[model samples]
Target: MTSLADTPKAPGALRYTLLINAAPQSSQASKSALRFAESLLQMGHNIERLFFYGDGVLNASSLTVMPQDEINIPAAWHALIEANGLSSVVCVSSAIRRGIVDTAEAQRHELYATSCFTSSEIGGLGQLIEALSNSDRMLSFG
Candidate 1:
């Protein structure tokens, strides 16, 4: 197996912004995005931000419980984000509409609890625009 240290870093490592647009259980988008992010990091490329839009915001839900036989996509994402100290953003509009909320959001909306993972924050399109401006590439998976 090729280890991360064995993988040659790309010259002039590029910064990337990843956009995920599908729900974790509904499709391969989340898995694909995760794999790509791992590859980028292993190759010494910088991920500026992980932007979850549309159904992709589901990936940031802490309440998601996958079957024992299946992989826990959200947990995997959480681990990756934590390990790499990556910036993860779930679109506030999409997240709220889908019932995913951080603590502040939960209080703001007068909900009983927060369901969003701690590693991700509910943000707006402005974050996406800023990420795009700072990164060399923006890739979308769905």
Candidate 2:
């Protein structure tokens, strides 16, 4: 198989949007997506948006308690997003359904607490569509 290092690099910085649809600990998809995003940024590409859908909404949850020996995927994602000032958005419906909510959402739904990370925001699919319209490429992992 062709390794990531063997992949051709873009000639110019391109805008990208990533769609992640797997849970943080459920599969390799979340890790792979993280690595890919890091690689892209390292190569000087711009991530226009990160749209987390389906189970991928779990990556934005601050309530995830990872084992000491395990990688904290959500925390990792938050760090990357914050460090790079990237636009990270979780699907509002998916996040709500999975019990991952921002303060506004929690209040709107009459929930007691907010579980979403500060670096990420709960948004609608319109954000995804806008990202798609503006980005040079869109990659989906799941």
- Provide the TM-score for each candidate, comma-separated: 0.92, 0.91
lDDT of 1 by residue, 4-120 (tens): 334456788898999999999999989999899888889888889999999999999899998899999899888888887889999999999999999899999999989999999
Output the lDDT of residue 126, model 1.
100
Model 2 error, position 74 (Å) = 0.4
User: Which pairs of residues collide in candidate 2?
Assistant: none
Give the per-residue lDDT of model 2 (tens digit) for 1-142.
1223233556887999999999988999999999999898878788999999999999998988999999999998988888878899999999998999998998899999999999999999999999999999999999
Which regions of candidate 2 are displaced past 4 Å?
1-11
lDDT of each candidate versus the true structure: 0.91, 0.91
In angstroms, the error of model 2 at 102 is 0.6
After TM-score superposition, what is the CA distance of residue 12 in candidate 2 from its true location, in Å? 0.4
